[model samples]
Target chain A: MLTKRIIPCLDIKDNRVVKGIKFLGLRDAGDPVEVARIYEEQLADELVFLDITASYENRKTLVNLVEEIAQNIFMPFTVGGGIRDSNDIRELLNAGADKVSINTQAVKCPDLITESSRKFGSQCIVVAIDAKKENDGWQVYINGGRTPVDLNAVEWAKKANELGAGEILLTSMDYDGTKDGYDLELTKNVVEAVSIPVIASGGAGKLEHFYDCFSQTGASACLAASLFHYQEYTIKQVKDFLKGKGVSVRQ
Target chain B: MIAIIDYGMGNIHSVQKALEHFGAKTVVTNNPKDIETSDKAILPGVGAFDDAMSELKKQKLIAALNKHIRQKKTFLGICLGMQLLLQNSEEANKSDGLGILEGEVRRFLDRKGFAVPHMGWNQLKIKNKNCPLLKDTPDNSYVYFCHSYYPQPKDKNIIAAVTDYGVDFTSILWQDNIYGVQFHPEKSQQTGLKILENFVNLC
Candidate 1:
């Protein structure tokens, strides 16, 4: 049986690990390679490195950083942000990233998901959805969560999966940075809506939050940045807590 | 040298890195001569069976791989590579495979409710206690996996280990000189590295 995964997300800017609170107020955490190495040693099931930088030059630096981390670390790592086309996804995969997450571009071109999934396998195509609670339902946000699209979060998730997205990285804007907990309602709805694995992101503040997300939702994985970047809890600590709660977690 | 057969399929860099990390000299190549000259060969693949087979044929690696395996050479196939060792796969419009192993690749829908692509880490239930590749690796050890289909080998004797998602399927296959795994050892972390080390030290 597949064990629940504990992933530490690294938000990268200019080749450095940066943490953004509610998608704002950037703070340096550490070097991408160094922080990735630590997460691997801490037994993080997987690592996610989102190249938060928008410039073409910074994207190159992120690729270089990905190579450095891949050379030093052995676990599966995902690279996201600024992935515009299949070529970008290929470049990152060739650079040693195990998977590539597409958010803004996937929304613009759902065929990009189909094309990439066909070129590469669906195993490597991760579609990330940044969603904020709107009215009674969640609305999809793009362009670093600054723009709200007309698509509904649940509806878009279903569409993304139908378009050949292997996994869904669902982030609840309402709960991001506040760390109250993952938006369980949104996560559960998304998980039920999609057949593929759903990774519950944003609003993970405490160890119990991890347990709650896993136990409450059908999420295959839980990802956090500040909780891990700030060193409030190590990956080991989170896993230990989950294991104690009778959740099947990889050791 | 351990040659990682890269027939324009999946990323072989991580596999190369893992082997070299354990002090094994390795090369990722598609050249028939390079594959033929290596002491052992590792076939790592990703993507559909039809495309993988076409690429292997395009690169002229199909013959080289079969010849090497015919002489009882050491070999390991990961994910799509492992599925290719089977007779055929249900994926990619029921494409034919290498026929190295006597079996048909089936999808996970046979057992409902489980995810189609069995992604993330899973435990191994040892079936072949004496399999060299799993020498030090404990039973039920966690290994990373990402695939929609699992091999249902015809001959049960060749099975080395099995993992259950919705159905009990072959996770590891070993027959004489050829070996294959449905999971990615390179991505399985410590236990995965240990399996690669065991494969590296295999006599």
Candidate 2:
């Protein structure tokens, strides 16, 4: 059966696994390889690493850091941030990434999505749409949610899917750090807009949020950062809770 | 010493790195003489089955490998490397395999809500307790796998470990001196590395 996945996203900056991952027993948590090893031991369903430094460094993608993380991680993972074109996607995938996540680049050159899928297959392409509440409606945010783009969330998801995006990663900035709960309304809307599997990201406080998102939003997976970074919730706990809710998970 | 057969299919660099981490002298070779002279051979591959086998046949090392097995030179195949050691694969349709093991590769059919390509970590259930390669592996331990078509063995004795994916399927195989892991040990965290280390330390 197609089980609901529990993913722990790692945000990389300056070739390190962001400062937020300072969990206990993981003194060198900022190291991508070390943090990845911990997550692998806990049996994370998959992992997603976003490189936030390359944009400032004017570098293409973090190939060196990718090589480091890929050494420790065994399951499928998606790498995103500063992925400009097919060449960048090719390099990351060649370095052992399962899929490439496109946000800013897809908005800049929508054709890159089509080109990437043609070269590396659609299953290797994922479109991550970071969104925030705008006047009672969700608006898309680009450039790591720093720049707000005047695009409707549902419309953006529909367009990205039409362009050959295999999956949609819908993240709500409103609840991102709050840990209130997933934006179920936004998740369900995007899920309805596209035929591809949608992974709901951001705003996961407790195990119930994960269970709620899977049931209400119909999202194939849920990705959390702070929750996992603090060791507040383990992937096994989330999976077991989802299983109790009658949602299928890997045993 | 481990000689990894590199015939344009595997990302031999990572495999080479992993084996060396265990302090094993690993050699990446496409030369038939290397396999003939090496103490043991490792077949590591990624990408499609037909492409990998074409490289093997193109290099004309298939006969050399058969002789190596007959001589009991220990062999290990990883991921698509293991799949290529089977009879045939349905991927790319009508592709001929090395026929080292009796089986055909086929896709995972869904009864309902099943994902294609079964790509993630899955727990392995040990079937044959006497298999030496499975030493120290915990029961129901998870291993990484990323393939659409899995090997279907004609002889049940060849089965080593099986994983349940909608339905139960063979996850590991051992026939005489030949050992194959469908999951990527080089990628599979500690449990996987321990298995690879066990293979390296085997007599």
Predicted structure with the largest lDDT when compared to the true one: 1
Off by over 4 Å in 2: A1-4, A25-29, A55-61, A72-76, A84-90, A93-99, A103-178, A185-198, A215-220, A231-251, B7-14, B57-64
Supply DockQ values for each candidate.
0.66, 0.19
True contacts kept of each: 0.59, 0.12
**Where in model 1 is the C-alpha error above 4 Å?**
A20-29, B110-113
Model 1 over residues A1-251: C-alpha lDDT tens digits?
78999898887778877763221122323667767767788889899988878578777777788778887788888999999998888788887888999999999999999999888888889999999988899999999999999999999999988888889999999999998999999999998888888999999999999998988888999999888877788888999999899999887
Model 2 — interface RMS deviation? 3.9
* Model 2 Cα lDDT, one tens digit per residue, A1-251: 34677889998887778758856798787788888878877878778988877664634348777766665565567888888888788778767677789998788788998887655556668899999988878999888889988898889988987887778889999988888999999998888777667889989999999989988887878999989888888888888888899987876
Rate residue B38 of model 2 by lDDT: 85
Q: What is each predicted model's overall lDDT from 0 to 1? A: 0.87, 0.80
Quote the chain B TM-score of every prediction: 0.96, 0.95
Per-residue alpha-carbon lDDT of model 1 for B59-121, expressed as tens digits? Answer: 999888998898788999899999999898888574588999898998878232365567899
